[model samples]
Target: MDRLHRQVGAVGLAAAAVLPGLSAQVDQHAAEVRDLLGVRGRRPTLTALASYTDGLLDGATGRGWQPPQHDLVGWAGADGVAVRLLALCALVTSAVA
Candidate 1:
């Protein structure tokens, strides 16, 4: 569970920094993350990330993604999950801004 805690904290920190200026609307920040992960209205933990990615990409592929892979990241060998996280992190940045 320690690793999960760390992951959550890291995500939160990344969110905070990406938020530009600090504010106490943590719940709002959290809501944005959930929405990006497509897991809103529920509490999220580390493990939900992989499942979320799988679900999101499942539909994304037919739209131009090619699946167990995609060109979203443009990296020759970056795994799908990594691409998902990068996308999710980027979404979080946008969600708040």
Candidate 2:
């Protein structure tokens, strides 16, 4: 019984440690969705926004499985527009996350 109690306590402690990270993930995703929809200042319609954001992120991840490579000039063109775009996305994702 003592061992079982110790295991339960450990499990509870582990959950307490992890819960905040899970909450932050949710909040960050919400912020990203808001930014994506150009609705940062306006009130969000939660139901629709959640679904739209999920679809958008899912499609984005599905399309790009690999990270962008470091190349001075590539498919993004000689101007490096593609590289810049990827950088912007990473910045936003980190900021929101």
Query: Could you give candidate 1's per-residue lDDT for residues 7-65 as a string of tens digits?
Result: 33345434444453322244454456588757677545555554665565567665665
Tell how far residue 31 is off in model 1, in angstroms: 4.7
- Give the root-mean-square deviation of each candidate in angstroms: 10.2, 15.7
Candidates' TM-scores? 0.31, 0.33
TM-score quality measure for candidate 1 = 0.31
Worst 10 residues of 1 by lDDT: 67-76
The alpha-carbon lDDT assigned to residue 77 of candidate 1 equals: 42
For lDDT, the strongest prediction is: 1
Every candidate's lDDT: 0.45, 0.39
Q: Which tens-of-lDDT digit does each residue in 1-97 have in candidate 2?
A: 2232232223322332345643344345556656876778554454544455346446655877333342322222211222223323333434445
